[model samples]
Target: MSDLVIGLGGLAMMFALMVFRMPVGMAMLAAGYFGTVLISGARSANALLVTETFSAASNYSLTVIPLFILMGNIASVAGFSSRLYEAAFAWVGFLRGGLASASIIGCAAFAAVSGSSVATAVTIGKVALPEMKRFRYSDALATGAIAAGGTLGFLIPPSTGFVLYAILTEESIGQLFMAGILPGLLLTALFMAAVALVTLKDPEAGPRGEWVSISMRMRALMRALPLVTVIIVSIGGIYLGVFTPVEAAGIGAGLVILMAIGMRKLDWRMLQQAVSDTVGTTAMLYLIVIGASVLNPFLALTHVPAMLGEAMTSAGLGPYGVLLLIIIAYLVLGMFMDGLAMLVVTIPIFFPIITGLGFDPIWFGVVAVIVIEMGMITPPVGLNVFVVKSVAQDVPMATIFRGVIPFWVAMAVCLLAVIVFPQIALTIPSAMFR
Candidate 1:
């Protein structure tokens, strides 16, 4: 078969496996192994598997993934996420839709320490859902807010996504982490604003509550001092060259664990659970990734992406038009796929074309992350939606999905801002480096 036909066939097979509920990693691994054997014969495919798996697993970059994952797990056991939410709530829980708004802020804070969207969603859902429910917050609003807020986990600093993106794109993790701050805040603000506005327009979604005293707010902030210190020290360390991203993850993880122990929130069982959970979660992510490594070579062998890139350029779409198309594609894909799986399947093809188009790598990285953030809250297979749905089981799955709509809108706007201004995403990296 022609390479395009072969490529298309392989892609179809992979998706079919996904539809069959095969793990993404297993599906990709199977498709890649078979596709390679079909196109290039057994011996060549055998060598490809050994070498690709080795290279993929052996890289220094991939080490960052498990470390970040481990750190999040440790922090989760430390009960740091609860404190973060309570801190945000004490300040924002008084306004219209403020409970929901507080959830978003809490998610952002948790993301600084917890890099996984699912972890952030589940953790925040546990802490904020009960409080929001007690206040008679709409099921849709409460559940949706947590799902949407959960996405901030992957976009904020110490994000595994950002770290992986830097590794794949060869951008500086420190700078990419730094570049993320403004855009991260921009996305969070957009989410909160959407929550407030939607609740304002539909008062039933959020009931009004009394504002708290300044003393209370200040005390609440003090309660989350460990998180604040971790953020400052880890981010400050990375940006200031005092530590690499990996080293910073260690520091953050250790500090959060120590604080949790100090607070007496963590028991021996919780600590064990943390380690076990981290290992399981990390294993799942790695499986899909290893599968991608095998599949990626096959995808390249087919040359479909390169051919498509050429065709896009030839169609008079220009670089920007193609970029627009890519963004739209990501938005659509985000609805159906896990963010990392989507990234693994797509970035190899997109990265070359993006760099070839002369777009700034740092800027595109931020934009891609925002797009992925959109995916985390999207339906069918959105991790964040599932996270919230699992925690708030009484709230129907559909309601949780619907609730994410406004935040998705906010995400869309944030995405556009990144696209149009570019500077909002790039200025920090550019300034710091130059």
Candidate 2:
């Protein structure tokens, strides 16, 4: 059989494993390992597996993942997430659908530290949902806001998505981080606009919250200062070229730990949990990276990416047409695949097509991350939707899905905006990196 046919069979088998509930990392590893044995020998395949696993695990840059995750975990354990939510609520809670809007803002803020959609949703949802419930906000609106907002965790700086994308594509981590900022903020605004439109249509769906006095608002902001300061210093340090991404992560994690301890919010137990959770998350991410590393070489041997690119180019679609087709494919895949899994599996195939089309890699990274995030809320396998359901058990899953529909539309709009105005994703990175 042709190597391409073998490659296709391997991919099919990989999906079959995933369908049978195998872990994504394991499925990729198995397919890549076995596929290699079929083409080369067991000897080469074994070497590939060992070298990739060790390389992925031992790579110094991977340290950023654990450190950033630790910072977020410690922040959550220390009640910093709640304080950030309270500050957001104090400032925006008085408007129509304001509480939901506050939840979005809270998610964006927490995402800066967390770099995880699930963590951002859980951290903000726990704090915001109960309060939104107390104010009698619609369950759909409340849950939807948090679910959609959580996706910012993947798009904002310190993002695991960008880190992985950089490693896969050999782009600058700082450039990708910078590329994400404007688009992330744009999505935040569009999400808030979605909340406004929802409440406008059905005013009772999201009622106005009681206004807080300026003094109280400032107090809440003060309470959130520690996290805010850490975000600024760490993320800002990257922008100013004062710290590498790994250094920023280390500083951010250390600063959060110090603040948490100083506030007496993290005791022995909480500290242990934070470290434990970070290790678990980091391990999972490392496995995915390793799996992708193994799979990429197998795919290269089959020339699948080159074949796919030739076919795409032969389709007579111009650059924009090809781009549109890829976006649609992502939306479809987002329905079934986990966002990170989709990224690791597909970037190798698509990055070459995109760059060959003369698009900016950094800009496409932002676009690609945003699209994958939409999948986190898409039905059937919406990871963020499930996370929200766990937090709001009384709310029907269908309702949460319905609630995110508007925000999903907003995301589509945001995607189109960035595509049409590539500068939205490129300007900050260009200015800073230049």
Candidate 3:
């Protein structure tokens, strides 16, 4: 059989394995190894596996993953996320739908430290949900805001999505990190606007929260100053060329650790738990990276990306047309697959097509992450929706889905804006790094 046929069969088998509840990394590894052995000899496949494993294990650039994960875990244990939520509430909680907006803002702030969407959702949801409930906020609006806001974790600087995308496409992680900043803030604004629109339609859904005095707001801000300082230092340091991405990660983690200790928040037990959590998350990420490394070579052998590129070019769909199709495909995949799994499964195939059409890889990385974020709230397997649901148990799954609808539309708008004016994603990176 032809290599293309073999490749297609391998993908089908991998999907079937995933359907049967197999881990995505293992399924990809199984398919990749089998396909490679079929196309090349078993000896070559064995050699590739050994080399890839070593490469993934020892890749210095990957240190950013663990350091950033450690920073987030420590911040969580230190109660920094709650401080962030309180600061946001002090500023915005008085307005109509302000509590929900505070949740979004708090999520964005926490996301600057923690790159995981579920972490952002769970952390902020825990702090903000009860307050919104006390204010008699509608379940849909309150839950939707948290679920949608959680997605900011994927697009903001220090994002694992961007880091993984950079590794896969061989783009500069710094540039991708820079590229995400403006777009991330833009999405945050759009999400807040969506909340406003929802509340405007039904003011009773989100009654106005109690306004705090200026002194209270100042105190809240001061309490959150450490977290804000860490974000500016780490992410801002990267843009200023003061530190590389890995260096920034190390500094960020160190700063958070110091802050936690100074606040008496870090005990031996808490420190141990944070380290353990970091190791587990890091291991899972490395496994996916290794699986992708194996699968990429197997796909290259099949020439599937080349074939698909040729087919798309021949089909007379211009660059944007082809991009639209790919975006739609991601949206569909997001409904069923985990976001990281979608990235691992699709990037090997789609990255080539994207770059082949002369699109900017960095900009495409931002776009891909936004689409993945959309999937995080998409129905069926919208991971963030389930995450928020877990925290807000009284709110039905259906209500959370309904709540995210407007925010999802807001994401669509942001996507269109970035596509039309690529500068939204590229301008900062260019000005800063060029």
Candidate 4:
């Protein structure tokens, strides 16, 4: 009868639907609609639905989503991602586990344009895996680097995860993007370190790649210049306050399209495919957002977040202690849920708790994203691992999982570092925005 009971039941039913292989958006929409009707009657529920649908549809900030997705898709079709890998390989391919390290660098660079982890992994893995194999790189090191590197997609600027978080929390998308820059770079370095450590322990696992000539390196760098320019213009423009997030997306997408056309790479077929993929990805993201929009009000009416916050405070867990518990919950849930699904479902409840503890929402967004990144590589449902496995079909699933372990530890270390010094994630946003 009580709103609290209704809310609790709705959550249980939603999870049950998910267990039955229902889509996350559909499950949430169904639960929220019925729960709202139960709590506030059918008339109120109908109005709520109408207004939420309209609000989600008309949101101007959401334009950035499709544009950014288009930018990445177009870049992929243009072969810019391959150039990025070649450039990184030219520079780092001489060291032990160099090709693997180059893969991480390439993934980081591509992630600046493409915001999806699976896309980054799949795109770079296709280029890096064969090269690593040619050089006799061990399957574990090769696969591990690709999977871990893919996670940079979530932490780097233009990240879809950050975009969704910004929309949900009413945080500034530009600020969140800036907040991610430092942490993204830090994790990339940590991944490279993981590769070095792995190869150091077993030289046979990651033999040195062929030495590239200086002239060849320069040529590769030149080839990658246009993409680097696009990244600097889009992301750097945001930091300088020259371009709004939406404008940056448009410019980025436009520039990539122009480059593809200039290089004669943008055929009618490629353009059509890029647009189609963008539409599908955008629709999926919007559905998740709309579902969260519908469910959020229902949860608010039940006062569930408030109750949970009070319970957490009363349990004698200090702010940091409470945050730790929440992080642990994310790690466990991440094993079974997609990162974005986990974000949309949990942020409504956790955002309030986090802000109530006097933490900055922007900082928490970065932390949450990092934890989500960890989830993408965690076993049982490590999405990136499976992505790499799909590319390297002959590699055992267990082997890829094993390869990702050191990188996983590295991610854990990066998480702790950010927690200890929140400024690692906040300084850029604070300085630039001020």
The whole-model lDDT of each prediction reads 0.84, 0.94, 0.93, 0.94
lDDT of 1: 0.84
What's the distance in Å from true for residue 248, model 1?
A: 0.7
In model 2, where is the ten-residue run with the lowest total lDDT? Answer: 55-64
Tell me the tens digit of each residue's lDDT in model 3 across 227-281.
9999999999999999999999999999999999998999999999999999998
lDDT of 1 by residue, 294-373 (tens): 88889889998898788777888888998998999998998888898788788878988889999988888888988998
Residue 34 lDDT in model 2? 98
Report, for all candidates in order, the number of backbone clashes: 0, 0, 0, 0
CA displacement after TM-score superposition, residue 218 of candidate 2 (Å): 0.7
For candidate 4, the lDDT comes to 0.94
Clashing residue pairs in candidate 2, if any?
A: none
Q: Please, what's the RMSD in Å of model 3?
A: 0.9
- Of the two candidates 2 and 3, the one with more favorable lDDT, higher being better, is 2
Better of 1 and 3 by TM-score: 3
By lDDT, the candidates rank as: 2, 4, 3, 1
Across 195-253, the per-residue lDDT of candidate 2 in tens digits comes to: 99999999989999999999999999999999999999999999999999999999999
Q: Candidate 4, which ten residues in sequence have the lowest lDDT sum?
A: 308-317
RMSD of each: 1.6, 0.7, 0.9, 0.9
Q: What lDDT, from 0 to 1, does candidate 2 have?
A: 0.94
The better-scoring model by TM-score among 1 and 2 is: 2
